[model samples]
Target chain A: MTSNLRFVFYPGCLVLQRMPQYELATKRLLAALGIGLQDMPQASCCGAPVVESFSDEWVYLAAYNLALAERLGLDVLTVCGSCTNSLKRARLALRDPEVREDVNRRLAALGLSVEGRAEVKHLLQVLMEHRAALKESVTAPLRLKVALTYPCQVFRPGDVAAFDDPLQPQSMHELVALTGAEIVETGVEHECCGSTLYTSNQPLALSAGRRKLEASRGADVLVDSCGNCHWLLERMQRAIWAGEPHKRLPVLFMPQLLGLALGLAPDELGVNSRVVALLGRDAHD
Target chain B: MIENCTHCGLCREVCPAEKLGGRTITSLLSGGDEYSAWLCCCCQLCQEVCPEGVDIHQVMMCERRREPAPDPHRRSFENVLRYGYAFPITEDINAMRSAHGLDPVELISAEQVRLLLHCL
Candidate 1:
């Protein structure tokens, strides 16, 4: 397959499994717009977050994934912002003559070494830049108003992979607008919704997620391009209701939200999950 | 010898460890009291983003190393962290990954879940 027609898509673990709807929706939307997503079959975790925290030894694993992409001769497209940040940081660090020499020495032990630069685009960045291309085929208009959220890792200072203002990014707003919807600015636009903390500290994650959900309670649907943010808010909304009929809120992944507006059926695009359930009937379905 | 009062809170505005309404970095550095500086996350983003480019995480870590981490619920949290079974494992079978030799199934930690995020 030629790289020109299809981008090498990297749907990091969360989007692939926990929220398969994201991948399904994204595939449908991209297909409608004549864009092909060549899933990077060999891609793996950018070594997760702790890989960056606990040891540089784990950094090599992510580096291996990056080098694999390099061999393919196309820049990688990562769905998770944290994965993008980690890969970008590793690439940046290894580019430094001193850092490269040091890291390469360790990598040599495993028979792997990353070469020069490669573009690591977040899913939002891809959508933002290509909105013009994708906007032409807007078949259905979205009526649901959305609250846009940009989590912390999407644009951290260390990796510096920001395409817009890291403090108050607008990619989500812009993309949602493509669906002909009003976008509201929530206070915790880039705040950590405590996704990683969810497994370790459910209380902490729920507390933080509640704060965000409460803030976006006004919107028709809370739209997040980040999987971590979407999952956290959705889970918290479930906890808040807990066997109650009124247990619901407007939480959705960016891809599914777009799919709804595009008039795709829920089953055709896999948007029938709880997230879209909050937005009322599958407008796309 | 008091290092002359060349009073410039430039050290305060530029330091990463000092919170928005917290103590100045110079005071912490000079007074040998590090508790005030131990809160830095050490990402060094603050220092690079700062105009003065102060190495605040380093300073904060230096002070933090001097004392024990102040975790009030350390004992309770330690139990949760050590067991890696903070959440109650579900009794009902929904979805699980099991090999030949395994100790039942349960959602363990963020680390394991994280792997599937990309792999899946």
Candidate 2:
């Protein structure tokens, strides 16, 4: 229950761009839980999923961020699953002598080196690890029913990126339960949100998202661990599947819901102003 | 030796791209279909469901790496290389941060990030 643990925060690209709300909520909630987060002033993208395979630069980019974290002398905490996965994968890959030599040679020009000592944990892991503290901090128990969705990175390849049970992650469910919200159901919990599919096939990505949204129709809110899934499930559904008569559900990133239970206001959590407005409308209904 | 594949199509059952392609994953992968490759989504679900333990996601990555055409994500990558972020930290974003009593977003110089990328 030690809340004094400090981690270097890596928000990754998607949060900074499309979902500052998640960042805002996370910062506030973590502060409330007495966990300290330090910022990396010069970190870049986490070499997000699809982009990594597109070029060799992706691995190096991921390595650069890892080396940056290593220099700070703190374990890294990432808000985005893609960032968590990329950094973790880079850390594992750098264990190879050749890969380390190659990456270090490149980093040498920038006067940085990958020590590979820094561990990367998703914010979900950090929160769940402190579950006792989180439960004690809940001042206002959430009364709504929620369905949880984890980013694909947290549960894949089983051996390397093993953040949880790949096929059936339990940490997210446990984390949500701490807020006193009921996990209404469990089907479609591990389905891909189709964020990466957008680049190649927008319709397929939308379809994948549509499937999840349709499946979660009975829940009052859809909960997500990463910003990309938030965007894919909520934003892309609006943009690409506008004509579809899918049930509309409020999607809350992990921190936002936790912040609510911690006594933070809707505005303080930076729940998308639009979502806030929608919630207002829901209250009247 | 284990059969390469029983053609069970279990991988296809879980594949988002294969479903979208309306074709076998082997056909979509071996035929060098760029659209199908792009649609793979890197979720690695196909790899998880394959009875033969075929790493179709890795196959997709290898094909994507060898693809001669410029990446659809090139512009965003360039933005990251140039700005140290893929999207702009606009006035509205800063306003939102400050509204929550949060400090403005920070970026290391794009030149600093670009230097590391260039070194690669």
lDDT of 1 by residue, A255-285 (tens): 7777677777766565546545655565345
Pairs clashing in candidate 2? none
Q: Give lDDT tens digits, candidate 1, residues B30-67.
A: 45343343233222344344445454434544454354
How much is A56 displaced in model 1, in angstroms?
2.2
Where model 2 places Cα greater than 4 Å from the true spot, the runs are A1-5, A240-246, A272-285, B1-8, B20-35, B49-55, B68-71, B88-96
Q: Which ten residues in a row have the lowest lDDT in candidate 2 chain A?
A: A276-285
Per-residue accuracy of model 2 over A139-243 as CA lDDT, tens digit each: 878777888787877667666676678777889888888888889775878877877777656777777787788788777789998878988887766765576
- Give model 2's TM-score versus the native structure: 0.87
Consecutive 10-residue window with the lowest summed lDDT within model 2 chain B: B29-38
